[model samples]
Target chain A: MKRVVILDPLWPLEESADVIATLDVTLDKAAEAVGDDVVAVLAAPEQRVPADLLDRAPNVRLVGTCSTGYDNLPVPELQAQGVTCIHVAGYCDDEVAEHTITLASALLRGVHQLDRFTREGGWWPFPREPRRIRGSRLGIVGFGRIGRLVAAQGNVLGMDVVAYDEYVDEATMRDLGVEKVDIDTLFETSDVVTLHAPLLPETRNLVNARRLAQMRDDAYLVNCARGPLVDHAALGDALIHGAIAGAAIDVYPVEPPPADEPAFGWPNLMVQPHSAWYSPAASLAPYTRQIDDLARFLRGETPVGVIPGGS
Target chain B: MRVICTDDTWPIDRAQATLDRVGATVEFAYEVPAGEDIVGLLTYPGCAIDASILERVPNLKVVATCSGGIDHLDVAGLAERGVACCNIRNFCDQEVADHTMALIYACLRGVVMLDGLVRSGSWWPYPQPPRVVRGARLGVVGFGAIGHLLVQNALGAGMEVLVVSQHAGADEIAAAGATKATLDEALSTSDVVSLITSVTDATRGMISTRELALMRSDAYLVNTARAALIDHEALGQALEAGEIAGCALDALPIEPAPPEEPARAWTNTILQPHAAFYSEASEARSFDNPAEDVARALAGEQPLGLLQPVS
Candidate 1:
């Protein structure tokens, strides 16, 4: 039987274990899968497969991951070892995109406050504040699958959808009917801003104090892409100082944020622990897709989802 | 009796204070993680409450739902076991109605995506997407409290409104500034269809494949009610095939949808995790209003919002 190693402990162990004769392991348990030249390795966002596992599994021709972010994988090592990496990227594109929109709308409409008062039930003796979305400006940071999807939904909300993706040409953006815009103009004009770009060296701390200072006084900011994409300290300070109206965040630089984190202390900030991609429907796609790719790879067929060689 | 609050504060505190005024012991657990049991359960929508949970607390006399919908609890099971079920349904009509319009505007304008792009430094070079909300047909599928609120908001936005509900008359709907139409007519002519109806046998699956087919290709739908009101597969198909422009679903057939459903990956859809009614005012209402019902129930007087006995 062909051995398949799964590096993520939290992957759908029940369904995937049945898909193939497999060696299921956490990142630490990965050594067991390497014996006798395992055919493939399946991974997820949190798992980091070491070089030893790659070297030991000599027959491992494919490294399949259940995540769009393959940064956790040792890509250079895999390339050097002649191993191809395939990822179930963009599987949660819509979920994340949808979440980004939800957070943006919430911030614009003062949802955290609304949630607070609604929980009290007329006890606060204060009239509720009201806001509408018809006149706001929405700026999208990345125009990938999720960004494009958010753009389509945003059009239905009646706000302008301005987007800036460095890799997307003006013509491509126009084709999607999204207006290509400059970063500064977007912040100054937008009533709300949401992030969907990949977290890369260039994008780290992308939403620093200088960029946030350009946003409208009542504008909202959201980051569902990656926590490092925004300077958390700057964002928390912005919320406290009212530099921006509010923020909704799902991803954090640190998971299970330490109890004393500034994000928890920010008055207008709403935080959801890195759970945007965890809807019941979105969670299974990555694992199932990884399994399918492994099945194909084991059959000596090139898996369809392999990331382009250069990427 | 002492009560422990969950992650929410405003409503629970108000209710706790009210109970305190009446000389009942109250203990608020400001942030109870999901699945942990407090001696008394002060519930909120999207918070986990189930039948098996009753086994853990022998002194539990009531399950107070802080929102209009009590489907989160096993009502029949609770009633049969002599546990009282109380829900606050009418307190946040205007607030929720306002949110429905907010979603309409958010979806139409691409507000969420644009906001993210600008603040992330990507908008410095891109143009904003075109957006319009005025003059569009706003269809209200359920002309209840929240629906009525949405009708007024839509009219204020300078849009023609359409109201479709089981109990609405032409004269009453016209008075609300919306033309009365059959569900099919509402689906077809609407630029935006908002659902605010209760989920029932007649209303369940109200918007299925046939109804969605009647919608204009560029039209959108918004639901702030139970997810069972619409057929999920039909909505997914409508979005994927571009049969309907898009949808904003605050509630889903299943909460925290299991990962793997293709719907999670669907583009052009907005999911809100069922929080439209959760303003601070609404939460306070949900908490205190339920107490009123409880007080009445305990007094041997018929409680407001008592579950209707099935025929």
Candidate 2:
């Protein structure tokens, strides 16, 4: 029997007929379960696998990560150690897309503020400033699966969607009926801009001061991608100086950004604690897919979405 | 002159008493009073008041409305025949603003869809998805009174707010503690962009396909402004292509949807019967001045809610 070690902390698993979990895995509960015959290691993209973690689990033959982005994995080392690697991609695309819409709509409609005002005992009665969304342009910064999904949803709501991706050609955009504008035009014309590109060497800080400066005065920025795509300090300055209108950030430079941090002081910024990825329904997708993939892999059947490279 | 008040309709009786206190004979109408000269029209939408009925009043000098919108009236032709027109535009600001928020929330939260799903026995196990509103960016396309109210409401919800109004100034927005962006900026970055501005030549079809392409694909749009502000076909294409997440429309380029229109079949979009500003409180406010304005104008006083000459 294969002994598998699970590392992601957010989900709870019931002891199943075939698989047993490494129970109570935490920093304080460390070193309690160095099983002698570990065959598989389960983890998430954000987590750092224990050092000597591979060697510590002597019988471990594979590492299965819960994310497509495998930046944390030392691929060459794992391959040299004779370990197979697995990654799950496109699992929570719709879920994250829906969440993106929810946040975006809430931002536009002033749902939080209105609900808060209503809950605060009529401190602010009377809608003081109402705006309309009709006749507005919507720009998307990336055109990946999730980005495309978001655009599709926006289209359903009667918005014009323009998209830009360095790698995607105009023909592809034309097929999608998307305007293939450069980054500067996108920044200048869009009333709402959302980030969806992956964090890569070429894509980091894509929304820098210069790009931010190109956006219209009343524009808003939303970041659900990695935080490195935006310079937080520059964003704060932009909001403070009224360079752009306001911003809603679901990802951050640092997770659980310090509670006492002064960066929270920017009046025109909205920050969610880096949690745009998981909704209850979406959380189940990858888990179920993982279980099914595991079952298929163990049965010597080809599993869907198995990353091609070994280790 | 004897004025008739319908059952439970506008407190025309109270208005009548006010009129009679100042010396005018008023009668309650279970039906349109026989042989009565009903000069001013105070009818609701979908009510029957044909042009032939107007010919009954030989001494009719003015037509007044007990509503903000005057779609029920033939204003142009009536004015051509020299009938002075009046309506009620104030007093419903808060109620209309509240209605706008309600539509916005309903669209963003998928309230209607989730409710239907749960009631139809497909509960999906989880209660409808939980969406976060805090720390999102809001773009208000029009900075009129209602738009400004929404901005304040968005702020109270902990959302970053921006205003896109050609009429407004940076100092005015800054004083309101909001960032002022141009319409272009507001469209691109707003997670949601709502319309609350009056429709004018400069504003008609403002959100063209070119502009819509500027918005982020994940964004949602809410429009409580005039329908002509957006290009509906462009919106339909955008929605079909997923250029935007979803939309909630309070106005249609064509009212009553003509039964054979494509808009009637759209499921993801939310379409109100264009009664967003017709709440109970709004109705009362609508009744206050217009009814009196017509009565006063009949008695030769200044009309309330009167429009200035269309310069």
Give one digit per residue, the lDDT tens place, for model 1 in A1-311: 55667666666656655665543322232534566547677776656667666556777777766888776667667867788888888677656765666666667665445434433332223233444555567899988998898786576556688998888998888877689999888888988898989777788999999989999877888887888889998888888898988888877776545655566667777666565665455657787878877777666777778876633
Cα RMSD, each candidate? 17.9, 17.2
Compared with the true structure, the alpha-carbon lDDT of candidate 1 equals 0.69
Report clashes for each candidate as comma-separated counts: 74, 67
> For each candidate, what's the DockQ?
0.04, 0.05
Best model number under DockQ = 2
Runs in model 2 with CA error above 4 Å?
A: A15-36, A50-59, A68-82, A113-130, A261-263, A273-275, A308-311, B1-311
* Candidate 2 C-alpha lDDT tens digits along A96-213: 5655655555445444343323223322222322233433566889998988877766664445778898888888876765777888889999878888887767888888999889
For model 1, how big is the CA root-mean-square deviation? 17.9
Top lDDT hit: 1
Candidate 1 residue spans exceeding 4 A from truth: A16-36, A51-59, A120-129, B1-98, B101-311
DockQ of 2: 0.05
